[model samples]
Target: MHNDVEEILFSKEDISRKVKELGEKISKDYNRDDEVVVVGVLKGANVFMADLIREIDIPVYIDFMAVSSYGYSTESSGIVRILKDLDLEIEGKHVLIIEDIIDTGLTLKYLTDNLKSRNIKSLKICTLLDKPKRRKCDLNIDYIGFEIPDKFIVGYGIDYGEKYRNLPYVASLKEETYK
Candidate 1:
């Protein structure tokens, strides 16, 4: 799997440090009395959310939503589908959405809109990676670990055709591997 990577974009230590910083900022921004409901966009954000929540000092309730815009393809379809919904009721609660990466921003925009209609008190977004060049919609990301260029990246819970998610660092895959 190492040979398949074109280059390592972020080491595990880099990611760890950034995640800890983001967590601390998040912990300080929200009131300690308010229990934030952290919503992780599954499969991809699973690893990031796990590490991020550990660094947070305030109380939090965790949940996951599996929304798909990309199937086996490297590019998004632009159409979002909710494979799984939250089990917890988020009405009037402070909500935070954790994402592995933000590419076109379509899926997250759709999700944010959907969640806003649920009567949540507030909604904020935190992404481990942001690809602003590929964005098709405007998004206000409250916490960003890194701003990455447009590339097919996989590792640390990000995957290509469900592979490479177990890798501890972020890397760009060799073109031939995905093509």
Candidate 2:
């Protein structure tokens, strides 16, 4: 028997269901034989992007972008830099930024602007989790998996000091965990 989870906020089933729903929406929005390129932020977004890409039908390509906002803090450093860029050129291709989470939106805003400057045919944002309270920029997310509270959560590709990404579901970290 499987052990009960300590705090499974968004279960695996929930995640799967949401991804399918978002996929359908995206498919309708981007109707074409050629699939849009889905770019995932590094580390935390790896798992979420893997699952989301499978759910999304059409001939899609995948790539990873590694970025760092803060070296050792939860707060944004207000500067975003790409540690790694797409192996596939994004010019003239429909691009969807698949992200694990959107907190302050600084990183995402920076990324979207950068991609726009590349002259892509289309650009959109798709995030599995949204933390509205922390959003610092005006943005629109084409496909959103879940809208969560401002609480600091770990698991389901989120982490606390680089831990808890392996958890099958999301959970708000214990108050004392960050203390």
Overall lDDT per candidate, in order of appearance: 0.95, 0.82
| Per-residue lDDT over 8-82 for candidate 2, one digit per residue giving the tens place of the 0 to 100 score | 678888988998888888877887765478899987898888888787777788888998786457678989878
The candidate that achieves the highest lDDT relative to the unseen native structure: 1
Task: List TM-scores for all candidates, in order.
Answer: 0.98, 0.92
The 10 consecutive residues of candidate 2 with the worst lDDT sum are 1-10
Whole-model lDDT, model 2 = 0.82
Clashing pairs in 1: none
Q: Number of clashing pairs, model 1?
A: 0
- Give the C-alpha miss distance for residue 110 in model 1, angstroms: 0.6
Task: Judge candidate 2 at residue 152 and give its lDDT.
Answer: 78
Residue-level lDDT tens digits of model 1 in 92-136: 999999999999999999999999999999999999999999999
Candidate 2 has what TM-score? 0.92
Candidate 1: list runs displaced more than 4 Å: none
